[model samples]
Target: MGYLLAVAAAVLFGANGSVTKIMMEAGLSPAQVTQFRLLGTAIVAGLVLVVVDRAAFRLPRRQWPVMIVLGIVGVAVLQATYAAAVQRLPVGIALLLEYTAVLMVALVAFFFFKEQVKTRLWVAIALVLVGLAVVARVWSSELDALGVVLAIGAAVCLAAYFLIGERQVAKTSALAVSFWTMTIATVFWSFVSGWWELDASVFTQPVDIGGVGGELVVPMLLPLLWNVVLGTFAPFLLSLAALRFLPATAAGIVASSEVIFAFAVAWLWLGETLDVVQIVGAAVVLAGVILAQTARAGKVVDADLALTTGPITTVRDTAVP
Candidate 1:
């Protein structure tokens, strides 16, 4: 059940990349796209929390600072960077870069946290480095410089999201955690998202939902609605539910399938294609993700806790209490 839920979430998240790109091409800035996503997630999560657990609405004072960081950096900034990367880069390539967070979490656990990592972790590191080189074709230096940088930025934020969320979920429910963090992100982005300046007419304009050169036209608002509901909220809940049945390590490995799904979806929907060499590189990177998932020891601090965001990578909490 856990594996199924995780994979389901990955499928939605993977498809969401192209959906997000479509919205941006329709004239919405990355920040505006992020604003809509975050705000919608917050509202939906808040409503669910109200009926399921109203007590989650009241967070302790000591939790405020950490929640703020998670909301602004992990949720808000991470989504913004990812949105921008998708706009400037192929959806598959952008997602491959962001998924580096899986390796980042493993390395942080080994070095800073002094966790007992498996010998295979070193092998995993080598595979990821080599695979990324092949995928990038760094010899050519053809991809946009800024797009690569933005994707890397998203990786950093995602790493923080996993590390911090591991602890937060031990103390609170996942729905509550999402609600608070997304609420913070929505509030933070509201001031600078430039949403007010967006002309209402843009939403009414026709957009090509078919990225494969077909003329499947729809109002821009349709995809935007899909982005907020099916793309973001639905997947997030599935990931969180998966944690209930699967150990963190197993969940992380299954969630890593998102990269594969992302590449496949983008190719079919947006016509993003990769060379033979790059395809092999992607396979190698996926093998590394499998190794990295098992690198760190699995310790369930709280059996009831389900710690994950939309992207369901897991990390051991190394912070001294």
Candidate 2:
């Protein structure tokens, strides 16, 4: 059950890339889509906490600053940059770039935190760098410079999420941490999302569903709901549930499959295809990520993994990809 739940959550998160791309292509800016996603997830998570365990809301005053930083930097900036990267890059490539956060985390732990790291860390970094070059096809200039930059930026923020969340989880329940972080993210986005500039009718507008031929059309609200509920909220809860049985390291490995799922979904849904070289590059990068995961075996907390994982979930145990 734990394995199944983890895989299910990974699939939802993987599918989110294509879903996000569809919304962006349909005329929503990355910021707007991110705002809606965080807001909806926040409301749903808040309601769940309210009904299931209202005591989860009673956070200590000392934790408020950490929650705010997590909301603004970890949730808000990380997601918005990822959305922006998806708009400018292929879904798979964008996810691949984000997955580098695992490498970044390992490096940060070794250098900044002074955690004891294995020699494999250096090899993992090298593999990822080479893989990124191949995936981007640096020789041909196939990747967008801005998109790559944003994706890398997302990785940096995701690294911070992992580092900070690791500590935060030590002090609170995973559900509480997720809820509060999302609440803060919602508040932060609400101020800068330019909600006042958005036309109300846009939500009712019919837009292309963005598949192979771009023939399907649906109300904008459908995908938005899907993004919030299935993409973000459901997967998050599923990941948390998985932790009841799976260890953090095992769950993290399973969650890493999200990158592969994202690639497959994008290819099937968005008609995005990568060349043989890029595919090999992606495989290499994933290998490096797995290697990094092994380097810090049993060191990562389940709650931290949940919050920092691929796309969404309170106890999400994502790849931070």
* Model 1: residues with Cα > 4 Å off, grouped in runs: 299-321
List model 2 lDDT by residue over 1-321, tens digit each. 889999998899889889999999998999999889888877887788888889889888888888788878888898889999999999888888888888887788788888887788778888998998899999999899999999999988787877887766556766676778777887888888887798878789897885886588889999999998888888878877777878767777788888999999999988899999999999999898877876763464232244332222223333332
The candidate scoring highest on TM-score is 2
lDDT of each prediction vs. the true structure? 0.78, 0.80
The global Cα lDDT (0 to 1) of model 1 is 0.78
What does candidate 1 score on TM?
0.91
Model 2 alpha-carbon miss at residue 292, Å:
0.4
Show model 2 residue runs off by greater than 4 Å: 301-321
Q: How many backbone collisions does model 2 have?
A: 6
Clashing pairs in 1: none
